[model samples]
Structures are given as structure tokens and as C-alpha cells.
Target: MKAIANALIVTIASASSALAASGAAADEGGFLAPLFLAFGAAIIAFQAIPAVMLLGSMVKGFFSKKAEAGANAR
Candidate 1:
């Protein structure tokens, strides 16, 4: 549990720093700025969304299988 807590802290810190740096970079640009930022965001979201969806499906599958097996034994 403590390890998990530490991991969460580190993830939060890293994400904050990364976002701060990206924000600073974006602010330095002119016209085409929002477009580039949106492109980068879309790429990141595309990658993250599929993995999140897969994780959710896996968790749901695990419980469904467990329930089915339990019901079969009864």
C-alpha cells in the first residue's frame, strides 16, 4: 500500500512537470500554435484511450468468467 502511495505521488509529480513544460512551450508560439497543441493532444489521447478501454474490458471479462465458473459449480 505504501509503495502504491509513493507511485501515485511520483506519477502526479511527473505529469504536473510535463504539463507545465508543454504549456510553457505552447505559450511561446504564435498562429499555428493551438493546431499543433491539439494534434499532440489527440495523438496522446488516441494511444491512452485504447489501452484504457482494453483494461476496462479485461477487468470486466475477469469478473464475468469468475461468476460463470462459480455458477457452473452450483
Candidate 2:
């Protein structure tokens, strides 16, 4: 229990002493960040349409009967 209390105190002290950089020291992703993010989102959206259609057809096929088998055998 004493070791646990010491560890907790150390954690609290380290957390309080940590600070973020001020002003010019901050990191930036530059002007192209939003453009890259938008492009990625658009790519995902375009890919999703075909994926949804394919999944829908697959699910429909699973629940559907193979009635065409008998007709084709004729």
C-alpha cells in the first residue's frame, strides 16, 4: 500500500509539471491538412457506395430461393 501511494504521488507530480509548448513552438500540419483529409473522406465515400450495393446483393442472395435451378434443369 505504501508503494502504491508513492507511485500515485509521483504520477500526480509528473502530470502537473507537464506543459504544452507556447506560440511558435507548437507543431502545425500546414495548409494541405484539410485538403488531404477531405480527399481521404471523399475516397471512402465513393468506395462505400459499391461496397453497400455488393453487400446488399449478397444478403439478398442468401435469403432468396434457388427456384431458378429447377427451371434451368428443364
Candidate 3:
């Protein structure tokens, strides 16, 4: 448990430093700014695919239950 706690603290500290470094990049005046923006946009676009699939699956499940119930009644 003590080792796990130490590891967690180290991970958090390193992550915070990395975030600070990324923030510093913005102050350097447009070096690869467009590339970073495009990367961020692409990340968001890729994430949307799984979300849409989950929504479609949920809708399919909902209607399939209704269809099954209707057929069973007949």
C-alpha cells in the first residue's frame, strides 16, 4: 500500500509538470499552432465515432424489444 501511494504521487506530479509544459508551448507565439489545433480537432473527431455507435446500439436495442413484443402478441 505504501509503494502504491508513492507511485500514485509520482505519477500525479509528473502529469502536472507535463501539463505545465504544454501550457508553456502556447506562449511561444504560433509555433506549429495550426498543427496542434488540427491534432486536437482530430482527437475529438475520433472520439465521436464510439459515442455514435453506442447511441445507435442503444436505439436498436430499444426498438428491437418493442418489435419482439409485438410479434409475440400476434
lDDT of 2 at 58: 100
User: Residue 11 error for model 3, in Å?
Assistant: 47
**Superposition error at 50 for model 3 (Å):** 0.8
Candidate that beats the other on TM-score, 1 or 3, i.e. the better one: 3
Say which prediction, candidate 1 or candidate 3, comes out ahead on lDDT: 3
| lDDT scores in order | 0.85, 0.86, 0.86
36 Cα displacement, candidate 2 (Å): 0.4
Q: Where does model 3 exceed 4 Å of error?
A: 1-28, 66-74
The sequence of per-residue lDDT tens digits that candidate 1 reaches over residues 6-60 is 9999999989978776655445577788899999999998999999999999998
Q: Judged by TM-score relative to the true structure, which candidate is superior, 2 or 3?
A: 2
Which of candidates 1 and 2 is the stronger one according to TM-score? 2
Query: TM-scores, in order shown?
Result: 0.41, 0.56, 0.47
Q: How close to the true structure is residue 32 of candidate 2, measured as C-alpha lDDT? A: 93
* Positional deviation of residue 45's Cα in model 3 after best superposition, in angstroms: 0.5
Model 1 reaches what TM-score against the true structure? 0.41
Ranking by TM-score: 2, 3, 1
